[model samples]
Target chain A: MSITAPQGFVAAGVTAGLKPSGRADVALVRNLGPSMSAAAVFTSNRVFAAPVKWSRQAVADGQLQAVILNSGGANACTGPEGFADSAATASRVADRLGLITDNVAVCSTGLIGVRLPMDLLLAGVDDAAASLAPDGGPDAARAIMTTDTVPKEAVAEGAGWSIGGMAKGAGMLAPGLATMLVVLTTDAELPADALQGALREATRLSFDRADSDGCMSTNDTVILMSSGASGVTPGVAEFTASLTALCQDLARHLIADAEGAAHEIAIEVTGAASERDAELVGREIARSNLFKCAIFGGDPNWGRVLSAIGVTDAAFDADDLDVSFNGVMVCRAGQIGEPRDLVDLSGRHVRVTVDLHAGDRSATILTNDLTYDYVKENAEYST
Target chain B: MSITAPQGFVAAGVTAGLKPSGRADVALVRNLGPSMSAAAVFTSNRVFAAPVKWSRQAVADGQLQAVILNSGGANACTGPEGFADSAATASRVADRLGLITDNVAVCSTGLIGVRLPMDLLLAGVDDAAASLAPDGGPDAARAIMTTDTVPKEAVAEGAGWSIGGMAKGAGMLAPGLATMLVVLTTDAELPADALQGALREATRLSFDRADSDGCMSTNDTVILMSSGASGVTPGVAEFTASLTALCQDLARHLIADAEGAAHEIAIEVTGAASERDAELVGREIARSNLFKCAIFGGDPNWGRVLSAIGVTDAAFDADDLDVSFNGVMVCRAGQIGEPRDLVDLSGRHVRVTVDLHAGDRSATILTNDLTYDYVKENAEYST
Candidate 1:
């Protein structure tokens, strides 16, 4: 289920003095390529990290040979010096690998507005590039994590094609393009345009629907690189389906590790006029503090859900809306439907369904409940 | 100040067995008018309470004599039967006072999605109508409170003109058009159009900037009634000034009594491209859970503030932004500015200022921080 499962790809992760705990802090992935066609998606936040700026430009020509990531300092808002540090790190990796600097992408996640320890980061990049191996994907996954409770890695394999990805984020995780730092590798020989098109389409349903908190990050980057060394080119239809499944698996892992999360809740909005409408309604309900707290306390307070949905522009009659929580019909046609018991909420998963009764288009958003530990963890986070 | 400080109005509050606690649950206010003209603003929430629907229809003709309010239950989503209940309440009050049913306005605040206790509610309405008095404003204010630690009332006097108001809301509070049930009474000889114009202008700067928990209610209503019992008419300039001061006072009281709120934080956004931009930035910062929790923990985490503002479309560079928390310059031009100990945030007031470095337009939003008690209180909230 790791990136090594992808054909003609090798990955490695190691510690090079970036974090004091000696956990993996540097990860490298290489595409043993006959063709280097690739694509990437990054955060839309205007205040982006230096690594994001470099990777965004690197993917402009739609080709990539490798990706290097670290998880100790974001190197964001550190001025011109931070940008130079990111470029220098990429250059050092390219020099050691005898590859073009523009063909390498970089990502960093951790504290913001702090200068990266260049001496340590550059040395880490060299060590990571040297340690790259076909079975190093798990180590690479462990290296690109900050506050994530577990490493997130997913893989989808078929007869002639393979898809694999690793993601790391627990907070500041809302979507414009993607939520956090992610690297996806594949071996199917696909055009650059096709890869980019498939990445965007896959993210719209997967990473885009995982909202832990409403904060969007400044360093969210998702890179998809194709080695094209396996001599297998699946049809676009199968490639897209595999990509969707892979992204969904990765998104589920992200939510399961959301910071201080209690129950992982799935909010489904059905019978909306359009997919966009359904997403809007689902996300709105997912982000409501009242609804989240109710889930935390195990109360079937359907009024809060209806009120949250009613505020959105999604077309639906309040009287025609129906809501269910954990298989209990709490509200029907906007009125209290059936009386349900408020019992233990200790389970790790919960489900909420909303029937908009407008159209067939629907969307599902994943979120976590608000709990006391969530408030405590974030309240003193900066200290 | 209570509503009775205003000239030419009678108010009363009574208990008629609606609430199990036997507290004041019904209130009545009447204008002994030589002229009767009014204007009102209703909640933008599509699923509104029955009283909101009735008042919206009643105020269409721009004339009103009385307002009947109950605080034990919000008759929302009770279907056609709910509308019938609202009309019957108005009819009972109108019959007692020999006034037209259309001249009476109704407002209710409490739990949503439950039908009004018809027998108790009707009895309370009749009792409140009979107990109406010229000096019962304080009683009326006390009656329309649910989970509020204190009652909110404000009064302002002009040269022969006067204005007063009462508000009730402890949660489900946020910006647009105010997030609670409010009734403003004025004795100035003014038409409905002038009252509407002034009310909108005042609310934009006052009630519209208050955010308790970022949840907009399903029963928000702000009504302004002109008894015109006093023959003197203030000029537009003077009337607006008085209205602004009155609203400001009421807004302060509302924030002071916000449920489970320990501190009142004022977020000011200055040097924006436009007033709208300033308000947008201020509200964004105010509603950020991270920022609110930081204040609660007494940590001056200015990075959260910068990141929150950075996500908006406001025309300001991160490096050009300056932020101060509780008089400490924590960030300058998006970078860490000054080194100071985090101020004590255990007090009842907190302030955050953001300098956008764009223009002179500015705005301020008042809000309360997220605390443990807030979650506990809201988690147990049910009908």
Candidate 2:
């Protein structure tokens, strides 16, 4: 169970013959609720996909009846015609579900700058609506995968309600949200304003900190919808914390299943003047190809980490910085500390900690090591 | 002949027993001139190497009689002890040449966070001092090689005078200067201010635009010394232009020999609101791993290019962007134009031109395609 694990949500996955592999390529999640409230975040990249433009408008009213997603073409940089295609897709979904067009959101992912096969996609939507089921979340999660090896789903329990989410991403994961498509559903009673605030706060600490390849996508979107079936209105603060944890769980899944990744890295920056500084330092280190390569080689290269940190505008004294790989401090007070060989990097999970010695604020960024497989998968992606 | 091609310059190379491979690891370039006027630039990275710190102070008085460079250890993040080692190396060089310690600059390259073997380096300086000759530039160039495949040397002649230079760098090349050590000798009469001005201007247009791997090093340095032996003073503007061309020539060599590089890509962004904007756009595209991987696969994936451009803060209308690969207009006005198959990318060189259609400014960034070998080289570098 994923999104449909929550009450008042039904979903379906259908084969559209859009993907060359002929896998399930379309999914639909409908909100059947006493109250419908929704919130969403999209890729900050200026060159967004057609479906992103359509869905932005659809979610502007903070209420959505359904969401239709396809994983065949990104429909990005396809100009006005692509926008029209997205609008037509929303119209088809709305017609099949007997919902208003403005309340139907659309998402598309795959190769950028290509148009979707409109006929097959519309037919798939019709079939998905006809096959909608409360237990279809897992199948729906599998349909949105492009290069992902497995479907990602997570659930967080509340007193009388719950939040369930599914995400699809494999590459081009960067800050401002990874190259991903995510849908979250909750059975808790909440207003649109509360849902919107919670979603923003949750994503800021979750999706915005995952910088896999430093390539922000043109088709990233995350949606959260609530239905009043559970009739338990949780406190805004409590709801936001739960949502953040769930998003982080899904983000971890995205990285663990990242395209060609061999190691999942957590760069934690502590003793910063502010949370922003900590994040800036972590992101800079996360994006350093040299550091990533060093990790992949099973080398505790704290020098690369310091060099990466030196490039950022974050508040830190060069001479006071300390770095650790795993539990071994490789650099202390900016000098060689323990023997680098003492730190082991053979494991798939690696944690690099940086102490700025500036303040108490901290942040962590999730990333992957740069490996030959990563190069292979990305080099051969569009070819 | 490289730096020794200019009058009043003597250089030598010697094995220092520092490199594990038993290669020559020490290089000495000395100015035996009627006038000693020098200007130099160091890496902007705050976490600079000990040699960089030492050289900055040595050249602060607008004069330098000698520069000693060593490979196999960068002497970075070594704290006070490393600085002491650099100072001792300079003092040894100065004493061997019967000059003041302040007149000698030191440079180091290779793995960071390691101390140089002082005894071997000092003895090698003695050997280099005894072996210094007017034709020793090429030997000195070879000694500075860490990962560089060849000795880089160039000469540019002026009326009754000339400028000669040598450089060594193959990886960790990025904007604000590549991970390189450059020594330039000029026989023409000039003041330190003029040399500094010309050096700054030349490097701005040349080395600063070459971003091979986007990993800035902590040990980058460029030194320009004027001998004034020719008694000919060229106008500053003419000398600056010649110096720029010379630096550009060396920069090209660095890119052509970038570590594990398959193709040398020139990403030129034109019609921008300003030169800074043009460069910003070019660098953004040059650094996009997705775009670099696509290039390695010989795919004219203009979508990656557009997506890269969309993430920049440069002034450009997303819908008005145009991209061409090898003269084929694959994307026009931000949409598909000619068939992508029409673009050929079978050669070692690739030119990706983006027309922002916003203004008259332009810039070109040189980079290398991400390749399996790149991953292999960087992954195994420290190990």
Candidate 3:
């Protein structure tokens, strides 16, 4: 049971030679329910992809019957032709599924600015539609990967219902959906507005804090579709919690598979004036190449951590800050406290706690340490 | 003849036990001028080091008699005790030179948060002052390096006057002076206000455009001094051009010798709505790890270029942009223009040009590709 764990969803992934490796590069997810309720979040970058532009408009009505996702070529910066290609892809999906084009959402991820091989992409769409099955969720998850080392999926079981999700993408991932195509299916009887609220709230705490490289993608999208197949109406708050938990799981998965990352860093910024201030501080540390490299090298260079904090507007006294690496307090009252040797980072997971000592608000952000493999993979990614 | 090439200046470097390698770690530059005029710019980071806080105040009156610099200790996030270390270092230097401490500036680099060995530092100040020589510029330059592979020095000759400078720092360098220390000496008879204005103007085009790694340093500083020994007061524009040229030369040197850099990238952003917009675009591109890695791999991935542009506030029509790698126009009208293989990137230097098709404004930024050695050096730096 995967995305098909939900009662009314069918998904498929197919290969149409779009990828040189002949890997599955096309995926489709359809919600055949009494009601089609959905919510989606896209990249905030102004120079977005053609698929993003089209999906933004298509997702406006808060209803979606199906979503078509493709890898191998991101239809971004392809000008009007890219937009036309995405439109044609959606129209073809709608025609195959006997649904209107407006009810079909599209997502594409790969090298940007190159036109999709229209002939192959259109053919792949038909194959994806014909192969749709409840157990095709894993294939769909694998289809939209660009540089991801593995497929990512999450499931949360509720009373007589469940939420299933599939995601693809690893680096170049940040807030505002960052990078990737995430499709979640839930059979619970929740309203569209409720799904939107739950998604935003969940993602704000989950995916929004997953800042791997501080690079935001042009084609990032996260969509959730409700089929109401369970016939079990749950409180929006309960659903939101379950949904957030599932999203958080997938978010962590992305960090684990991040490019060239030797360590997964979880920075917890406590005692900020506000949540935004906490986020800003944590993100500054997450994005610091100095700190990231220190983590990669297994050095508890807390000075780089403190310096990264000093560059932000977060409310923290230079003389009163506290920093802990792993579980040892390396800095106390803004001065070196314990010997850095007391702390250990010889593991894949490293946690740094920075207490701003300003207020009670706090935020936790996840990032990956800079590594040699990340450089190798990205340097020759499109070659 | 670097710092001391200009008349009325003497420089010295001395060994201090601060660095484990026992390399020279203390440098002093003195002004023996008929007109003692000086100006300095410091990192705008909120968490600046003790020396930055001290020098910002000392140089405020624009009458610096000397600057004492040290490596192996950043003296950042060490709180009030750190500030005292900077103050005591200045006082010791001033006492030996028979001058007030307020007339002396200070700069420090290396591992942050560690208090400088005050005993070693103070003793080294005396040694540096006693050994002051007119030809000690190269030694002074070498004393302040951390991970730099070579010393960065530049000279520009003018009519009856010359400007000479030395710089240290690589990586974690960006605007607001990046993470570097620069000392520029001139024999021109310029007033403090003129020196300040000229320094700002020159740095706006030179040091400010060197955006390597996009990490701001708490100890970053660039100082300019006029000794009036040559007795020639060139026009402000001429002095600005000469100083800017010298700084630009050192800036290029910094990029060329940047740690773990396989390619030197000169990103030129043209057709922007404003110069600020152009700079924003260029800097965004310079900071993108994905884009930098592509350059390191010798991949002419212009799509990564567009993604970087999309994340900035720079005014540009996504549909009308053009990009060139090396000399090949890989993207035109925001679509694939030429085959990426048509371009070559085997050389040490590479250029990426972005045509926004928005307006006439343009700006250029210098950067280096993300390399494994960068990861290796930076990862193991603090360890």
Candidate 4:
């Protein structure tokens, strides 16, 4: 019970013969309610998949009756024909559901610069929309995976309404956004604008803070749909907080399942002049290959952390910085303080704290280490 | 003969008990000159080593009598005491050579936030100064290494004089200026300003373009010394070209010796609006961990190349980009073209060509594939 965990929503996952494994490769979620509204965020990359182009326009109407997703080919860099394929896909989904094309959103994930298996894909849309069920969210989540080993799903209950979501991604997951595909559903009474506001605030602190591989994807998209079935009109702050907490949970799920990652690092940056400084410092350290490699080796190399932050424009004095790995203060006041060997890293969860010693704002960035298996998985991804 | 391949430089490498391996960890280079003109560059990282701070000031007068470099400790983030250690080391070298402390530059590399073994270091300075010889460049080259497997040395000759140089750096080689220490000796009758201009242009094309691991070090320092012993007033063009070629040779050496690297990747971004665009695009691809990992697996994942450039502000239409892995042209006009398997990465050399088709300028960036040994070395480095 993923997306179906919420009321007034039905979903289905079906085999499209698009993937070489012939696994379930198509997913659909439909709104069945008195009110239909949605908001979405797509990849910031200028080069995106065909469905991203189509869905971006479809969501502009502030309401969506259905969302159709396929995982096999990215349909990115495929010229004008790719966009035509996506539009045809939305039209086909609309034909089966008896709705206009603008009320349908579309997304795709997989290899870039290749055309989708359109024949099998269009047929799967009809098969999927026909089989929509309230309990099909987990299957829908599984259908959208490329390299992910498991499906990701979460839920957050509000006063009388609830939010449920499912996501699929494992690589190219730096989230400017990642090649991530996500759909969240709620039965709360909210307009598209309100949903959009909540979604932006939630993602900014959740998915946006994850810097898994420092590589932004071309097919990232996250959607939020509301049906107003429960008729609970929660305040903006109340709704946004719950959504943010839910997204943070999903973000942790993403990192825990990240490809080739042996350790999940929580880099919390504290004492910054502004929130941006803290986030920038955290991202700078998270993206350092040397630091990641050191973590993979289970060595507490605080110098790599300091060197990583030294390149950023964050407000911090070099002499006033402090670093702690695990629970040991290996570096304090900018100098070696404790024996690095005293800090153990045998556990999968590692926390590194970088104290800017400047102000009060802080931020956390989630990432994984640079490992041999990560190299192997990605090297053989397309092969 | 490395730096001493020129006419008026003496050098030596001696063990100082700074390294546990008992290897030579101290290096000294002296300019026995008719004219004592010199120019140098330091790391752009604000959080730099004490030696970088001392050397930046020592070379401000455009003259340096000698340069003392040590391995095994960076002496960074060690507070006022670290600066004192650098100053003391410089003063001791000045006493041995009978030069002002202000004219003696010092450099240190290795673990950051730790102080150098000052007692052992000062004694090694005396030993190095006593053994300085006209043909001691190779020993000096070997002494400055931290994790490097081999010494990097290069020489290029002008009409009547020659320029010779040595460098040491492997990890953290993305220079905010080349994150390495270098010493160049030339016997031409050139002014300090002339040498500075030549060094900048040469390094901008050479070491500055090699972004190994995309990590910037705090101890990067490059010093150029001119004895003017040959009295050769070569034209600026002749000297600049020779210097650029020699620096390029050293840059290749650095990439080849990069830690945990198996294949060397030359990312050439062509048809850009400006040289800066070309460089930015090249670096965007070269710094990609996914792309580097893909290269290590001998898989031609040209999609990773396209995605890397998509995140940059370089001038390029997504539809017109073309990518080739070693000449197979896997992507043409932004769509799938030749089969990815047609590209062979069986050798140690791999070249990726991305044609923006946006303009006339182009640039090449040198990097290495991410490998297991790289992760192993960095993980165990501090231990």
Candidate 5:
């Protein structure tokens, strides 16, 4: 049911008093392993948080033993002091675990440019390390949440291994991984190179394709660790598939929890010249304000859909394209295929499919409809 | 005054019943040309309206005598029949004026799909021609408006000639000249190539940089015509400067009238490696929903600005970037420069300045804040 369901991993979550609501704001997970190999992917945004800078550098070693995460302060855009605070937090965790500081990773999320509550975070790290348990995954999941309606965690069992993860993101989400911050753990025996390769591929189709608001975050990151405690050593292909599924499930959960979203929309682009082209078209539609607003209003405005794709450089003539909304053929061969009154959109789930007529390559992107609440929530968020 | 406030032109606006409200929905303007040279621009969107296709081809002849415009039903995506309607409308206008059909351009805006009410449009075209007057600019301005709160018209008087224009756009606005439809008329004599060159140069910095909602339209266009009826041939250099100022003025009006917008935000990006880089950075910040929402709520959340720019490919280290919101230094060298409580955004205008520290190039983009009404208006727009 939780990320710690995997073997050889102990985790704990605790309150650091950083959040005014007294919610859990600090989490720790350690790999009690015969071997510790890990890989990580970070936000492509040139502007990065202090913690992200540290974690990215540490992962260059291709191995990690533990990760320390905190919420309520992103420790981003806080200058030299922010980097020192992140390093100090990681050092405190490593010191408590009697491990080398270089073997630990750090991640922080929440409001950007606010100083980390050093006194509270340092104490919370100690508490989390002492309380670490095999069944502490749920608590860890709860600690890394900010404006999320619910805790997102998923586990998938395989023939001999299992994949599990926890994620926290609701806004500032778009391509280049959005504001996603995820941690995945598995008991499979895999090298760091293999894990990195699998993560890049899986994320490209999962988190990288989930564009909720089209705002990339400076703190987006995903780290994967293998404890090698299960001794399963499954084939790389099977492990990769399980990892991909886990990521997809977590992505779905993230989309469902998108801030102020009323409906989860899936935009599918088929018959593109390449998978990249299909993804480009699909993402363009997903990020379109007009398309999203129409979805929110429960209007099957297929003209807006086709118009969104029309601006892209994809090799498809307008007349050669076919668009369907929720199984209704709203447009065919670039012409209005159905009356606007014919399509019913009062439901929660909406599916839009676009056929490019170029090649067999296709892609699907998960997004949320732009709603009144989305504007209200985000507009009032900083205030 | 209106687009024909310039000396050598006459215009008219008439009710055609194209809109159920029985408002003026048809307009006509003619260049009383002793020298009939013109320049025009069309939407870059591949899924263009039928009128756009016709106008592009008609303008290819390097000479234009008149333009006919209608609102309430954009003849877009109606297939071959839509093309026929566009031709028919142009033909009707040519017949009334006794000019070649190829010399008369056409433009249509409003809801997509539904065919034009040919009976109403044809009759209204005749009325517009009959009622054409040198001072009928205001009527023509009113006829070409759809969902616009008011008619947009401006006039600039020079030494011996004048420049006047009208525009209509309230939403679906973004980089590729937004969803705006503009008609500019000048009395000074100039060749079509010079007009075309000036139009392109002015639009590059004016219309192309007005990003209110980041939704490019299928019917965006701007047409510039010279009557040469004044016989006052200003130097090309002076004429181009006047035209550029006119475009900037109109672009500002368009941004001011963006749908449901409560505030106009100006984003300036400086010290980029190239003008393109600066524009890219400025556009990224301008189109950020989170940043726009923050400004809407009067919250000076500066981190959103930095993160938005960081996602671009511009060459600037995060640590070397600085951001200011509404004259308050919120970020310095990619770090928090001022307390959130210190920045005040309780005004109808917001200004954001970003310094990349990479080079000397700079650019500015005008946008409007994302508000609840914006969502409401766009969601129910078509329905």
Candidate 6:
């Protein structure tokens, strides 16, 4: 179950002739709510997609009754014609559901700078609206995938309410939101402001830390819709904590299934002067292609880690820094520590810990090693 | 002809049994000067090598007599003992040449976090000092090769004065200085202060814009020494211009010989509000792995370029951007323009020009395409 795991929600996935593979390419999620409350976040890239511009306005009033998402065309860098296409898509979805156009959101992902096939998309919307069902969560999740190998979904239960989420992303995963599309739903009575705050905080901790590659996308969007069918008003802290956990679970799934990834690595930075510094250090290491390549070769080359850290503005003494691969401290006091041969990197999971020896703050960044498969997949992706 | 192409320079190359391949790995350049005016620049990375730390002080007084460079082991992240080793190497060079220890600088390149074999390095320095001759520039150039496929050398003539340089770097080529070791010898009559100003400006326009892999190194150094043997005091502008051209020539060689690179790409950003903004846009595009991969695959994917520009804080209207590949305008007004098939990337040189249409400022960044061999080389580098 994905968005439909929450009560008072229905979803549908339909085949659209937008992809050459003839796979399902359109998904529709409807909230049969006693009350409509919503919040959303979009890619920070200035040159964003048409669907992102449309959804930004649709959710501005903090009310959304339905969402329509499609894969096979990002509809980005297409100018005014693309924006018009997005508006028409939402309008069609709203008309089919007997709802206002402004209460419908749209999302798109795939090749950029291309116009969406409007006729096929519109027909798929009609099919999806007619096929909406309470058990269509998994189908909806699968329809939003581009290069993702598997569908991702997660849930968190509260006192008498629950939250569910689904995410789709593979390559082009970075901060300012990954090249991804995510939809979340909760069957709890909550104000739009509270939901917005919780979503922002949760995404900051989850999606923001999952930097598979240092490439930000132009068509990323994450939307949350709440239906008051559960009628349970939990404490603000409780809701935010549960939402963060659920988002993290979904984020891990995204990294685990990232395109051509052979290993899932976590770079944890501790003993920093501030949380921001810790994050900066971890992000720098995550973005170091040299470090990632060394990890792929199963070589605990901590020198690359030190070189990456030296490029950041984080507070730390070069001579006091320490780095450990897995459980073996390979570098201490900026010099050789334990024998590098003692570390093992043959597993699919690896952890690199760095002690900055600055303060007590800490942060972790999730990333994947740079391998030939990564280059092959990305080189042949758009072609 | 390389560094010794100038009138008052002698150089030598020697093997120290440090490299497993039994290749020459030690270089020495001596200034036979009437006036020893010198200036230099090192890597901006805080976690620099021991040789960098030692050379910083050696050239601090605006004067130097000789430089000792070694490949096969970069004395970086090697603690206090590494510093001692650098000082000892410099002292040995000074002793052999009958100069003060403070006037001799050292440079090292290769695998980081490893200590140099002091016994071999010191012995090699003695051999290099004894072998120094006026026509040994090419030998010195070949000795500093780590992964470089060819020696890079350039000479700029100005009346009776001339400047000659030799550089060695291949993989860790990025801004903050490409993981390079460069020695420049000039027979012009100039003060240390003038050489310093000219070197900084020349490098800012050349080496600073060459970002191959976006992985800065722990050991990058460039030194310019004046022998004052030409007895010609040319205008400062003429000398600066020649130096800039010479540096740009060497920078191009570094990019052309970059590790596993199939194409040398020049990302030029024009019509920017400021030169800084143009560089910011160009560098961001140069650092995008997706853009690099697309170039390697010979795909005219202009969307990746737009997406990269969108991430920067540069001044540009989303709808006003235009991108051209090899003079074929593939994107105009932020949308598809000419047929992408009209652009061909079968050559070794690719020119990607992005028009921001914001103002009149322009800049260019040199980079290389991402390839499978690149990942392979870096992945198996340390092992």
lDDT of 5 by residue, A262-293 (tens): 99889999999999889989998997888899
- Listed in order, the DockQ scores are 0.62, 0.85, 0.77, 0.78, 0.84, 0.84
Clashing pairs in 1: none
- lDDT of each residue in A1-383, candidate 1, tens digit only: 48888888988998977776778899999888888999988887877878999999888999999898999888887777888988998899899898899999999988776778998888888888889898999999999988888999988986777888999988777767434788998888999999999998888879999987777777889999998866898888789889988998899999899877888999999999999989999988887777888888888778888878878889999899888887777788888687757433568899899999999999999988877777787776651
TM-scores vs. true structure, each candidate: 0.96, 0.99, 0.97, 0.98, 0.99, 0.99
Candidates 3 and 5 compared: the better one by DockQ is 5
Q: Evaluate residue A51 in candidate 2 and report its C-alpha lDDT on the 0 to 100 scale.
A: 91
RMSD list, candidates in order: 1.9, 1.0, 1.6, 1.4, 1.2, 0.8
- What's model 2's lDDT at A130? 95
| Local accuracy of candidate 1 as per-residue lDDT tens digits, B1-383 | 46666777889999977777788989888877877898888888777778999999999999888899998888887778888999999998899888999999999887777888989888888888888888899999999988887889988899997998999888878877456788899889999999988988888888899888777777888888888877888997899889988888888888888877778999999999999999989988877777777787887777668767877899798778888888877777777677637555668899899999999999999998877777777777753
CAPRI class assigned to model 1: medium
Q: Indicate which candidate wins on DockQ.
A: 2
Mark the 10 consecutive residues where model 1 chain A has the least summed lDDT: A337-346
As for DockQ, the candidate ahead, 2 or 5, is 2
Q: Would you give the TM-score of chain B in model 5?
A: 0.98
lDDT of 5 by residue, B114-198 (tens): 7888988999899999999999889999998887888989887778888899998889888888787899999888889999998
Give a tens-digit lDDT track for model 4, residues B1-383.
77999898999999999999889999999999988899988888878889999999999889988999999888887889999999999999999999889999999998887788899999999999999998999999999998889999988888789999999988888956657889999999899999889988988999899998899988899899999999998988889999999988999999999988999989998999999999999998998888888898888887788888888998999889999999999998888889877989989999999999999999999999888888888777771
* lDDT of all predictions: 0.84, 0.93, 0.89, 0.90, 0.88, 0.93
Across A131-226, the per-residue lDDT of candidate 4 in tens digits comes to 899998988999998888889999999989999999988888895665598999999989999999999999889898998889988889999999
- Give the true-contact fraction for every prediction, in order: 0.47, 0.80, 0.85, 0.81, 0.82, 0.76
| Chain B TM-score, structure 1 | 0.98
Off by over 4 Å in 3: none
Interface CA root-mean-square deviation for model 4: 1.2
DockQ of 2: 0.85
